[model samples]
Target: MNFFGTIFSYIRETYVDRLSYFPSNIKISLMIILFCAIAIVELYIYIIFRRVIKANQNKQTKYWKERIGNMLASVVVYDESENTAEIAVHFYDKLKKLPLKNSTVNQILTSEIITYHKNFTGKIPEVLALLYAKLKLDKRSKKKIDSKHWETKIEGIREANEMGISEMAEEIIKYTDDENGLLRMEAQAAYLKLSNKDPFHFLDRAQERILDWHQLVLFEIITKNKKLTIPSFSKWLRSPNDTVVMFCLKLIDHFMQFDAAEEVQRLLKHHNTRIVKKSIEIIGKLELEELEKHMFEIYFDHTDEIKLEILNSLGKISSGKYADFLSSRIHSNDSKIKRAALYAIKRDADHGEARLLEIYHHTSPENQALITHVLDNRIKQ
Candidate 1:
């Protein structure tokens, strides 16, 4: 019996030992509860600590930003940008170096200065800002870049000068030796736009490179005062060069006397199609009486080219008397010349519409259709 009690006591102690240390079911439950409680406390503490750290960092950054902004007020004008102002001030104080470079930094600084002036709330400051921009654009420390570059920069300076931009014309003239015609032309146009003046008088020798459009505008300005400068007119009008002659023809047809018109008319007989077309254009611009004489003189001598030119001039002249002359062309064996005459007749054929209607009904279906189409298109417009 003592031996049985001893065995039972040994079994009970082993069971208790297992529960306390090695883990029975009850011990496993207790361990799991205790581990979950500790994990919950640790996670809560981590969250609180992270929030505290973020708040402290933000506070420190804000404090530093404000402090530097207050300090920068001594040297530069303070505007909005509260945070950036603080940071910029701190960067300036910590570094002995400036925020901008000597060459390009002035540009940055100039824009900043303009902003500062604008923030001050007055036109005076705005004007000063403009002057600042002009000053920085013009102050060339070295001439490493070509004249074109300098001229372009100088153009900005002159532009800021407004009515005074003409002074920059002298600077632009310095670049005339430039091989680049485009740059030279830009300078010429810029000079014209700025000064409300003409450089063409001075550019007489350089007119070969002057484009037609630019020359026309500049010509208008130079002649704006009605100062009667005939020598320039003669050089432009009688020049053997086609472009110059075309420009002259355009100007003279619009503004010159009949004498100039007569000159272009004489050149129509010249072999060049250019001169012929130009004269046809001039005839459109002339009075009907003036046109009748010229068209009559050229009428009988009809090369296919001259025939077309006369037809074009007659359409512009539009006299009923010539409707008969044109009617004869309808009978011509040349189909194109007949069609051309039909167009002229259809245009001036007020009393002759009966003749056209008669011709339409009697003529071939193709001729009838062609004439009918031309009449429809012309009359509808």
Candidate 2:
């Protein structure tokens, strides 16, 4: 045993001596320096990510505040436009249909975050009109923006020369900031093709930072003024921020854009399940049956928020193919989702009454009242 112990000690010492030759002190110092450098890089990356996220969030918040103010004003205007007491009631109904799920301020913020930066045209008119609509509306005394990009806009204003194309340019400049979406789109059409065709030319350079402009411009180009809105809007649906995609779904209100169904399907592969569920829900909002398959998938997800959204949307729209999935969610362990399922079934459907009644009698009093509300709505319908 002693001999074996001596041999082991000798081997250990030999290993230690070999290790010592590696300059242990220098190695330790190098390791410490490397660790610190890695830590610094990690910290720098964190700070950058935080700053970007904060900036994005801040912009959204600002837009939200602007939207709430505009919506409130629009609501008031709508009330006065109506000659009767029903104006207030109609205005409330319209407000209810709006995509806003939170306070008007927060809803605007949420929409802005998902809203394309290039699409500022939609919101720009909101800001400009509000600024001029009422003195009470003017909060910022900031400098007014130049209506024209530069002297080209001024020179184009020489319609007396009969320069037809130049006159068109002038028309665009004049209405680029107009409250009307059609006019704004006309302005975008006057420039987009020509600008991209000869990108290096001065005419294109005039709108060099166009992509950075508020998405009101993009939306005008993509939606109201023309047919260009879908592909661009579809691109945004797969964006990193789910909020951006959410608003994209909201803006895409037309039936033709509903053909972009496949793009929304691509969103099911999104890393965030909330975003995936929202994409499907938006399809559901558009009354598209294609969203049913994804609805089934989202219904099975463990997330409460995603499940609730699916339940709500599926209950409203999923009729033929996705009904079974919606039925299964009624049996979900989650009381909220189950209650929502019962409510949706009761309102838009009658087949689920037996299941709903089973829960109505068996579930708690609060749940029973909710189920009763659904049944009452069904009776009224």
Candidate 3:
């Protein structure tokens, strides 16, 4: 053993001495090559480790999904018993015994349950809600609502809302005042879902501009719930937040709350151009003849956008009484105004075609072209 050790030491010393004699550049180059080799080995090991982890995760996901899918299928197909509540309890008991109740498994169950919950309504969804609550997934989601991560909290709110966890409404409402816009929107949607007693409660105090996408979502949710006691949207028409007022206008238009026609007429003279424009649209839709004079009164006090909207409203109203205003605009130097006037006139074919022919004989070429386009292109069926 001593002889072998001595031979090894001698060889290593000889190698080190030879390396020490190498020029500085060659030594650096060799050191770089050594480091590169080490990095490549480490990277290869890391890649292999990641692939192994991914494969294991995929295997576990498949296992849990299969188990959960079987449970869901049994609920929908195999369980012929009309008593879904009892079956939901029994299935939840079985679900609790499944192996590996980790985050991944929980996520899979959540996604699966949400898919079924959205597809069905009435007692079916109610039973699934019981299953979700019994599985303690609702508790997990509630815990996530308090998570330090914003996205996690949003996901928690969404899960609670989608699963119909009404108990979490107060907890969800706390985030409605969050600084993050997406988080705030999600929280509001959750609140709307869980708290149907007063769905638009947050809108009363909302400070931000409710985006168009958010409006569409809330509209769908509110409109679909037949049991909901929809309050008077006119209460929000005077909101200090323009977005709230704007959203209220849409609600009014959609519900066709003719009682709010008085308020809608008053808003036509609002200083905000959007409020005025939307008011015009709602007026036209409701066909509140009393509101026509308000639009005509404010016609010259607003911008071109408001002007076009007013003309559009006049066209929609299609009453012969607004013909004088359209006739006046037909002679204006602004071609857009002329087109709007022509459109308004063309809309009133019963009373305005004679005036259209009479104007064609005396108007500017631009006005005549516009008249010709309207009379030809906007033909009545």
Candidate 4:
């Protein structure tokens, strides 16, 4: 019995010692199973916690937005001169009682106030601006400008500009060089909005490419002034950055800055196709009749698109030998070139009808159809 008991003890110690005698592969598999079970439970708990937090935040936002909306409506909807004093006192007392520590609520209130300003302009915007000052929202927005995240900083810049916080202009200008394109664009626009004395100071030094959409936004803002100190875009025509030069050319043409005509003629010889195209557009629009010879000289050295544009520009300058020049292209195989040449002939040349008839008699059926279409369109017009 003692021997049997000793053997039983040895067996228990060697094989039944809580999985110690298991194969290595089985031991590792068991560990992995145990780890997966724990991880699944933890992930399940985390998901529940997130859902609870989101729901609580939604409730808090709803409560705060309601309280702030009523206060804002009173200030925006009330008459500026008469009811403002009573509303101001009521608003301040209520605002002081409300908890301003909730950043979500602050953002909600800021958006509501900005919405009021966006929709209405006169005395209401002024009232909202005063209310914004009284609530000290500007401090909150200004704080976001220094945030580590680029999007947060851009939002702060936007809110600052929307509220007419003129002091933020210099701070906003610092972001114009941000590597992110959207951030740079928003910062530049905000700079223009906040800086009244020098609204265009950013454009003057901006070496970045001003895209077409960016130009449209800037143009709309600059033209809104009842009495604007319009700067001479000629200053930027010589900028080494081609995009800046292109933007200045567009501004000059849109604003009809005729003084830049001499500077514009110089860009016709520029190597960039886009710049040359825009220069041609400006010349055509402004009727710069003196550059006809230069236009003809550059015609053969450019693409078909540029050639078509040259014909269009030549059509605008009727005083020179552009008619005889266009006559040479009337037989080109490229249909667009031939069409443009015909259009230029009719518009620029005095004996263009005789030229069209002569071409029709000797040309192919396709060419005859093109000339006949041009003549018919002229009579219809």
lDDT scores for all predictions? 0.55, 0.51, 0.83, 0.81
Evaluated with TM-score, which candidate comes out highest? 4
lDDT of 1 by residue, 121-227 (tens): 53334333344434433343112122336554543433333323344555555443345655555555545444434454434434454567666765675457354
Model 3: colliding residue pairs: none
Tens digits of per-residue lDDT, candidate 3, 198-301, equal 76788876887778898888888789978678888998888888878898899899899988988888888787888889999988888888788898998888
Which scores greater on lDDT, model 2 or model 3?
3
lDDT-sorted candidate list, best first: 3, 4, 1, 2
Give the alpha carbon lDDT tens digit for every residue of 302-366 in model 2. Answer: 47887776676666673745545555554566778766677556544546677567666766677
If scored against the real structure, what TM-score would every candidate get? 0.48, 0.39, 0.79, 0.82
TM-score of model 4 relative to the true fold?
Answer: 0.82
What is the overall TM-score of model 2 with all chains considered together?
0.39
Q: How many backbone clashes can be found in candidate 1?
A: 0
**Native-to-model Cα distance after best TM-score fit, residue 271 in candidate 1, in Å:** 5.4
**Model 2 ranges with Cα > 4 A deviation:** 1-213, 216-248, 272-274, 320-335, 350-355, 358-366, 378-381
Q: Which candidate model has the greater lDDT, 1 or 4?
A: 4
Candidate 3 residue spans exceeding 4 A from truth: 1-59, 99-101, 119-124, 318-321, 346-350, 357-373, 376-381
Q: Which candidate wins on lDDT? A: 3
> Between the candidate structures 1 and 3, which one is better when assessed by lDDT?
3
